[model samples]
Structures are given as C-alpha cells and as structure tokens.
Target chain A: MQGMSPIVKNMTRLVAGFIVLFGVYIVLYGHMTPGGGFAGGVILAGGLALVVLAFGEEFARKALTHEAAKTADSIGAMLFLLIALLGYAGGVFFTNLLPVGEVGKLFSAGIIAPCNIAIGIKVGAGLFGVFVALAVFRRAGAGSSTGMIEG
Target chain B: MDPVLLLLLVLLGFMLAGSLIAVETRDLLSSVICVGAVGFGTSLVFLLLGAPDLALTQVVVEILVLVVLVRVVITRRDETHATSRATLPVGLVLLALGVMAAIVFGTLATGEDEGLTMRPFGDPLLNEQAEASVMAPAGEKAPEGAPARMPKSAGGAFLAHGLSESQGSRGTGAANYVMGILLDYRAYDTLGEATVVFVAVLGVYAVLRKVGRSRHAGNESDR
Candidate 1:
C-alpha cells in the first residue's frame, strides 16, 4: 500500500522515535512508576502503529516483517517462562530468587524488572503481529472482491 | 462531597454519555470515536481514584483498542449493518442491570454496620492501629512465641508494615506495593495472565493465517 501525504510521513519520521523512547522508558521504570510492562507494551505498539499509519503497509512490512514479529513474540514468551522456571532453583515456582537490593532504587526489585521486560516484549511483538495479519488479510479481501463490490 | 469527588462524578457522567452515543450512533467511525472518548474518560476516573497505574494501563489499552477497531471498520465496506431489532439486546441489558441491582441491594441489607460504613476519606486511625499491632516489641508477645494479633484490615496492614522491617516479618522488599503484590507475592497469577494473552494472540494469528491460505487455495482452484 502507498503511504500517506508527505506531511504525515515527515511528522511520523520526526515523532515515532520519541514515542518509542517514551514507551521504553515506561517499560524500564515500570517497577517504580505507574506504567508497567502491559501499558508500556501497548504504547510501544501504538508508536509502531503510528508509523504503519503514516508510511503505509508496504513500508511497515519492510521495517517489521511478519516472520520477525512472530519470532520476537515466541522469544518473549520463552524468556518469561524461563524466568519463572528459574525460580524453581530457589525452592519454589515463581519465587523471587534473586537478591532484593535496597528499596526505592531502580535495580532493587529482583525478578520484577526482568519479568516486566519479558512481558513488554511479548505484548509489543504480539500486538504488532496481530496488526500486520489483519492488514494483510484486509488487502487480500480487497483484491479478491474488488470489482464485485464496486459494480 | 469533596471537590475531587464532584469532578469524578462529572467525568463519570461524560463517560456514560459517551457510551450511550457510541451505541446509538449508526456511523461506524463516529461510534468508534465515541467509545474511545468513553475509554479516555474512564482513565481519567481511574486517575481521580488515585490509581495512576490503572489509569496508565487504561489509556494505553484504549489506544490499542481504538487503533485495531478503526482499522477493522475502515477495511470493511459494509458499514451500514445497523438493524432495527433492538428488543433482545435491550432485554438482556435490563436483565443484567436487574441482577447487579439485586446484588448491590442484597449486600447492603445483609452487611454488618461496621462493614457497610466506610471510613472517612484520608482517615489515619486505621493506619495507627495497624502500626501499633505490627510494630510491637518481642516482649509484648501474648504467650509462647506467637506475636500479637495484627489488624483485620489488610489494606491498613499493608500500608503500615509492608514497606519497612517490622517485628519479625520482613516486608516485601520492593518499594512499590502494587508491583510487590503482582510480581513477588502473586507471580503465578501474573504468569497465568501472560499465558492468556499469549493464547489470545496465537488464536488471532491462527484464524487469520487459515483464512488467507484458504482464500489462496480457492483462487488457484478457480484457475
């Protein structure tokens, strides 16, 4: 699909970076702040969706392919499960096995940070994959029923 | 009522109005936008309730929902699918409302006076009592080794003792109580939620991929 107007493309180029950075910030600081993995992941997906909206489907596919998204989604899920399983070494499932440093600091939370990261990755990739799939399906539907609907 | 409560009431009113408009509107795009407005208003309500975490989640989820729904609506050419038959839906809604009302009234009728009456906003008596109970010295133990009984109010106990080193119990090391509860104390539940999300995404992928492949096979067969 062709992209939007030059204005929108230019605006997206300028704004998408900051949007992504903000999402990352939210994900990283989730343990201390209000925003967590889920919220930040959705925000990250939104930033990417903005790029898809501005630059169109073809450009988005090039930047973030379906295969890559699927891989990332699986990797994220595996990482989360790995973290949970790792807790078994500490004598219980999903236990906070790592050392809990001083409270109120960024790295103080033992397993929470890693858990948040895993969740963020999983949610972000999963959402983007869904969007791509929907878009591709829509394009295919349009192709098959083009003249049938118009006439 | 406090000014904050008044403001919250106004926001709730707008939320209701937006939802009503969203349901009543025939134009798909307008309906989606109205639903988004309602979602945004709900986030504001969460903020007013002093739950910034919930507010953030609500806003981001709303954005994602808006994007996906708008994409779906825009892709389909058949936007005028509004039917005049509203009896079944209306009746179902009324039934649900009746159930909710009955539950609320039943709780109010059967609940004890102490349980029914909420503490005044920003009351500190509960916190003080919780601190006294949990922070007591070892010498104040009742019998053999059992410590003094703690406060019945879980919220008060958490607020008073969950952050710092109390009598013999070590508080959850995390500064954020919500994170502590979700990730540390109840990590299994969180894992379950994550699994649910993963399954949902997988379902979407499977359904879409199947449709695409079937469509392709149909085109090839026609040739």
Candidate 2:
C-alpha cells in the first residue's frame, strides 16, 4: 500500500521516536512507577502501529519485517523462561536469586526489574507481530496477490 | 454526593451514552469510534478510582481493539448498515440485567452480619493495625484450637509483612508491592500469563500464514 501525504509521513518521523522512548521509560521504571511491562509494551506497540498507520504497509514492513518481529517475540519469551529457570539454582522455581539492594533504586528490585524487561519485550514484539500479520493478511486478501505473503 | 462520586457518575453517564450510540449507529466506522469512546471513558473511570495500572491497561487494550476493529471495518466493504436483531435478544439482555441487579441488591441487603466488616473508603486504620500486629509479635502464635489473630484484611497484611523483614522471613525485596506480588511472590502465574500471550500471537501467525499460502497456491494454479 502507498503511504500518506508528506505531512503525515514527516509528523510520524518526528513523533514515533518520542513515543518509543516513553514506552521504554515506562518499562524500565515499571517497578517504581504505575506503568509496568504490559502497559509499557502496549504503548510501544501503539508507537509502532502509529508508524504503520502513517506510512502505510510497505514502509512498516521494511522497518520491522514479520520475521524480525517473530524472532524478537521468541527471544523475549525464551529470555523470560530462562530467568525463571535460573531461579532453580536457589532451590525453587522463580526464586529471587539476585541480591535485593536498597529499595526505590532502579537496580534494587531483585528479579522484578529484569522480569519486567523480559515481559515488556515479549509483549511489545508479540503485539507488533499480531498487527503485522493482520495487516498483511488483510492486504493480501484485498486483491493484492503479490503482497507480504510471498515476501 | 462526594466530588469524586459525582465525577464518576458523570463519566458513567457518558460511558452509557457512548455504548448506546455504538449499538444504535448504522455506520460501522462511527460504531467502532463510539465503542472506543466508551472504552476511553471506562479507562478514565479506572484512573479516577485510583487504579492507574488498570487505567493504563484498559487504555492500551482499548487502543488495540480500536485498531483491529477499524481495520476489520475498512477491509469488509459490504454490510455498511448493521442489521437490527429481534426483540428476544433485547428482552434477554434486560432480563439478565434485572437478575444482576437483584443479586447485587440482595447481597447488599444482607449487610455485614455474615462475619464481614465494612471499612471506610481509603482509610488507613487497617494498615496501622497490621503494622501494630507485625510489631507486637506477641500474637504471632495462637493456641491450636483458638481463632486466628491475623489481620482481617489481606492487603494490609501484605503491605505490612510482604515487603519488609517480618515473621522470621525475608519478604519480597521489590519496593513496588504489585511487582513483588507478580514477579517474586507469584512468578509462576505471571509465567503462565506470558505463555498464554505467546501462544495467542503464535496462533495468529499460524492462521495468517496458512491463509497466505493457500491464496498464493490458488493464484499459481490459476496462472
């Protein structure tokens, strides 16, 4: 699909970065703030969706391919599972194996921060992949025989 | 009425109006937008209720739902007007609403006589009591046959003992109680939820991949 006017494209270029950065901040400061991994990840996906909406399908595909999203999703999930499994060394599943430092600090929450990061990545990538899949499928079914399916 | 309650009532009114408009709208796009407005209103209610996490989640979910619904509406060119259904479904809905109202009123009529205590909204007395109990350590162990002396409210107990050094156990180290509960206290549950989301995304990918492949094959066969 062709993109929108230059105005929309330029605005998307200007705004998408700030949205993504805000999402990252929410995810990273999840332990101290109201927004957590899930909320932040959805925000991140919204940012990506904004880009897709502004620039249309082709540009989004080039920036974040379906394969890349799938890989990120898998990696995020695996990383979360790996973190959980690592707790086995502490003689229990999902044990807080890391040292608990002073509270309110960024690195103070043992395992919770890392867990949030993992969940954030997983949720963001997974939602983006779903959007891409749905968008591509709709495009393909709409008389575009040579759309994302072959790619 | 209290100012917060008054504001909540106004928001609820808007939400109800939005829902009604969404149901009655003939234009699909307008209907989707109306539903999104309802969702946004509900999220605002959540925020006003002091549940920022829930508000954030609701807002994000609403956005995603809006995106998907808009996409679906855009793709399907047919059926511009929504068909009006029979009155039976509406009757059933009203009946369900009546039943829910009856249940709620009946429960409220029962009062706090059933070993339930009603506390003032946003009162910190329970927290203080829990803190006192934690500090005393005298009532930690009750007689085997006697009643338990723990705090009546579980949340206050969590706040008192879940994060700090208490009861000869090291509490969850996370400063944020919600994170502590989710990742440290009940990490397995979070893992399961993550797994569910993962499976859902994979299912979407698989379904789309199959459709794409079949369509491609059909095009090739035609050629």
Candidate 3:
C-alpha cells in the first residue's frame, strides 16, 4: 500500500482507460462479436477497480456508490425483464414488442442491443458496488462494531 | 447419434455435474462458482445451437445473479461452511433418471415437430400476381386470391415485406426473430418480466437502504 511511484500510477491510468474503451467497443459491437454485455460489463468494472486500486478506495466510492449504482442497476434490469414480459400479453412470453429492422444494421436487432447496454450498465455498477461496499466495511472502518484492531 | 447430439450430451453432462457440485458443496463460495460454471456451460450450448440471443441473455443473467449472490455473501454474518447432504448414492441415481428423462423427452419432441415446408405446388399464379402487386409502386389494387405479398397497412406494408424477405432468406432468424417476437408479438409478457426486475431491484434497494439508514442513525447517536 506504500511507495506507489508516479510512473506506476500513470501506467495504471492508461491501462484503465484502455480497458473502459474496449468494454464500450465490445458492447456496441455485441451483435457481431464474442463480447457482449457480460464481458463488457466486467471489463468496465475492471477499469473502475484499477482506478480504485491505484488511487484509493475513498476516491472510487466518491465516484460510484452502492446507493446510486443500485438504482441505475435496477432500472437497467427492469427494462430488460419488462421487455421479456411484454411478449406474454401478446400471447407469448419473451416476444418482440417492437418491429425488427433490417438485419445486420446497427438498429436492426430490435431491442437486443438496447437490452445489452442496460445489462452492461447494471453489471458494471453492481460489481463496483460490491467491491466498494466490501472495502468500506473492511478497510474504511465504516461497517460493523468490529472496528480495525491496531496491532 | 449425430455429432451435434453427442456434443450436446457431453455438455449437458458437464452442466449436470457442475450443478450437483454446486448443490452438494458445503462452502458457499464454491457453490456459487459451480453455479456460474453451469451457467457458462449452458450459454455455450445455446451459442452452439445458433441461439446467440438466448446465449447473450443467459450470460447476462448469470452475471447479475452472481453479483447479487456475492454481495449477500459478503454482507452476511455467518461466513462459515454450510452442511452438505450425505446422500451421494441417491443423488447419483436421481441425476441419472433426470438426465435420461430429459434426453428421451428432447428426442421425442424433436421427432414430433416436422418443420414448415413449401406448399405441395410450385409458386401458384396467386404468388406471381401478388409479386406484381407488391412491385406496383403505389395506388394499386391487388387481384383477388393473390398471395398478399404485402400487408394492407400502407405505412408498414413495405417494411413488412422487406422484413419477411430478409428474415426468411436465411435461417438466422431463430435468434433475431425471437427478439422481434418477444417485444412485438408478446409485448404484454415483457411488461411482466420488467415488473419482476423492478420488484427485485426494489427489494434489494429496500434492504440496502435500510442498512444505510440504520448505520447513519447509529453514527448520529454516537455523536
């Protein structure tokens, strides 16, 4: 936790930026690539984790919190599930409620990509929330009566 | 047996094994990990079967479930090992029975459903006439008994025709079409699913929010 040099900090920042960008790329090109919401979300979370690791947990918590992230994550998940359920009222479960556009085009896959984006946001935020909450409870002396024991 | 069928069986075996481990493992973390492995295997099988959409959905759901489970595990008071049931012999027999039943049902179902085939006759005169009616730019009445290449709705007729051609040309619609059918033809079902998600999020929020409020109250009293 000590002696983190300036060069190491800069390198970490650069890698984090790349990881976040790559995650975005994967989510956007989900229809054509092996990477989609899950892969992209984790990649995005990894970027956030790098920042927390290099800078500090306090800084990360300030940027993203469990309370706020929890809301957005819920919204994203709700939207996807809602879309799936809409199919049932139409006489089937998980039916497409919207018209399918030209295949292979960016807007062609109906709501699939939008659903993917929602999932990506939910997952990224959820993972970050987990890590930050743990850090706060354990290292930040924020949760529980068993405070840090000074050796 | 077809190579694809054989491969599917192997994958299913792997999934069953992982799920059994997940259920039988005493350690919570290991069980979670095993459950994730099962999800990953199922997703892979979906991908192989040309259902990329389902695969994507499965993977995303798995990640979400895992994240929630991990969070709960982290917050819980008890971090010790859980008890594993001591019925290995019974478990194996049940597993075998389940697997056999699944395979038998799957094969029987597949055999029962013969896919859509072209009509007995070649393209009827109605089809040709319908094609002409479709090609007619605008302000045209299609002849009687025409194949009705396009829908009656002028606004969406062109779009519908284009969609059918694109989707029917290749068999790729198994995935893409599912999404279309899910949202459009079954909008109501989607509403329920969304509600479930909303409810789940609300439940999680309520718990986490309560935790925060109690902690905040505790801090105030300490002050």
Candidate 4:
C-alpha cells in the first residue's frame, strides 16, 4: 500500500510523537496517577498504529520491525516475571523487594514502577506487532479475490 | 435526581442510540463509524464518572479499534453472499435483552437496604468501613483536631491507615488507591492478567501465520 494523501502524512508527523510521549508519561506516573501499565501500553500501540496508517506498512516496519517487536514482547513479559521472582528474597512472591520511600515521588514506589515499565513495554510492542502481522503480511493487490479474508 | 445523574442518563441514551445505529446500519463504513461514536460516548461516561484512567484508555482503545476495523472493511471487500437474517439469534438476543433490563430495573427498585442494590458503587464493603471509621476512638497519642482514626486493619489494601496526616503514609504508601491495590495488595492478580495478555498475543501471532506446525522438524524453511 502507498498510504494516504500528504495531508494525513503531515498530520501524523505532528500528532503521533505527542501521543507516544503522553503514553510514556502515563506509564511512568502509573503509581501516582490513574492510568497504569495496561492503559498506557495501549496508548503507545495506538500511536504506532496511527503512524502505520498514515505512512504505510513499510514505514511502520521500519519504525518498529517485526523482529524487534517480537523480542521486546518476550523481554517485557520475562522482565515482569523476573521482578515477581525477585520478591522471593522477601517472604512471599510479588513482594515489594525494593525499599519504598515516601510516596507521590517518582522513585518512592519501589518495584511497582519497574513492573509498570515492563508491562508497558510488553503490551505496547505486542500490540503493535499484532497490528503489523494482521495488516501488512498479505501481498499488495492480491487481496481482492484471493484474500485472506476467508482464511 | 442530581444534575450529574441527569447528564449521565442523557449521555447513556446517546450511546444507546449510537450502538443501535451501529448494529442496524447496512453500510460497513457507517457501521464502523457508529461503533466509534458509541465508544467515544462510553469514554465520555467514564470521564463523567470521575474515572479519568478508564476514559483515557477507552478513548485510545476506541481509536485503535476504529482504525483497525475501518481499514479492514475498506480494503477487503466482503464477497460472501448476504444471507437472510435467522430468527433464532434475533429471538435469543431480544430475550436476553429483556431479561437484562428486568434484572437491572428490579435491582434499582430494590431499596438501599437490600442486597445487590445499585446505590453503592465501587467497593461497598469499603464504604461500610469508611462509615464505621468515622466514629473511631482516638489512638493513645492522638493530637487535637486529628482526622478520624481508623481501627486496627487486616492485610488488605483498602484499610487506608489513618495514623498520620502525611500523604504517602496511607496504607500501601502509593498515592493512587487503584495502583496500590493493583501492584502492592494484589500484584499476583496483575501477574495473572499480564500472563493472559502475553499468551493471547502469542496465540494471535501463531494463528495469523501458520504454514506448518511450529516445532515440526525442518519447519524453519517456511520462513
């Protein structure tokens, strides 16, 4: 696919970065704010989807390669599990292993922040990968009659 | 009712109308757009209900779903011949709708004293705890004008300790109660949820691309 008109491309250029930034902000501040890993990760994926829609599949693959996304997806899930396992040093599983300081500050929430980051990475990369797999795998113009729609 | 409740009802009505249109529309693109409108309407309801996190997530998710649905419907024409509407599904749906409406209105009509009352929203037990804590006896070292002291608490995160006036000292220490519950008190549940998502994405990847069994000998050549 050649993507949409120049208007869409320009608009995506201006807006997509902010959307990603906002997602990061939400993920990082998850402990202190309303949004956490799940919501912020979805936002990040949505931003990438916007980029892909405006700039075509090739640009999206370049922006976040299929291989890299797959790797990130695995790493995020493993990191989260590793964090949980680290809690074994304490009495129980999923314990707050890191020392928690006074709340409302960035560094005070102990392992929660790290867990949020891990989940964010996993979800964002996994969803973007899902989008790419779904939309871009088919050969261009071959979708009319011999499409994967019935597949 | 209050102005907020009235506004919420109106917004809900709009959302219901949008969903009906989405379901009834013949054109695929218009149906998808109507679905988007209903989703945005639900997002607005979330915002009005003082849940900004849900609103934010809903808005972004709605956008992504809209993008995906619109792109697929637009690019891939559905060549399958349209069949006549089956009566069984229509009857079943209407039956389900009728039962749900009856249950909802019945519960609403039930007084506040009854079980399953809709009046109490979000952690009804916590509400009771809050009410009980208001009459709490002061601790031994209580200072004058100190806020309501909480009783001795159990292991759960909802027991927001009333010991100190400090912001972070609230039980579980994290500022947001939802975060505290999600990460500190019930972190394992979060882990389980993450696992579900992980497995689901993996399933999608596997299902979307299948040439041969993945682990079969010499299957690497498919790449």
The RMSD of every model to the true structure, in order and in angstroms, is: 5.6, 5.5, 10.4, 5.3
lDDT of each: 0.75, 0.76, 0.58, 0.75
TM for every model, in the order presented, reads: 0.80, 0.81, 0.55, 0.81
| Chain A TM-score, structure 1 | 0.91
Tens-place lDDT per residue, model 4, B38-79, is 999889888887778789878888888888888878876654
By TM-score, who's the top model here?
2
DockQ scores for all predicted structures:
0.48, 0.53, 0.16, 0.48
Off by over 4 Å in 2: A141-151, B89-151, B166-170, B210-212, B216-223
Q: Which ranges of candidate 1 are over 4 A from the true structure?
A: A145-151, B86-157, B163-172, B210-212, B216-223
Name the weakest run of 10 consecutive residues (lDDT summed) in model 3 chain A: A142-151
Question: Residues B114-206, candidate 3, lDDT per residue (tens digit)?
Answer: 454332221122222234366434784443333556444333333343344443212122233444444334445644555554455455444
Off by over 4 Å in 4: A140-149, B87-157, B162-171, B210-223
Ordered by TM-score, highest first, the candidates read 2, 4, 1, 3
CAPRI accuracy category, model 2: medium
Worst 10 residues of 3 chain B by lDDT: B120-129
Error of 1 at B169 (Å): 12
lDDT tens digits, residues A38-132, model 1?
88888888898888878887886678777888898899889989999998998888877777777777886788889889989989989888887
For candidate 2, write residues B42-153 as lDDT tens digits.
8998888777888988999799879978976776666865567766687899998899677545533434463553342333244333323543335563322222343445
lDDT of 3 at A22: 86
Q: What is candidate 1's CA lDDT for residue A77?
A: 89
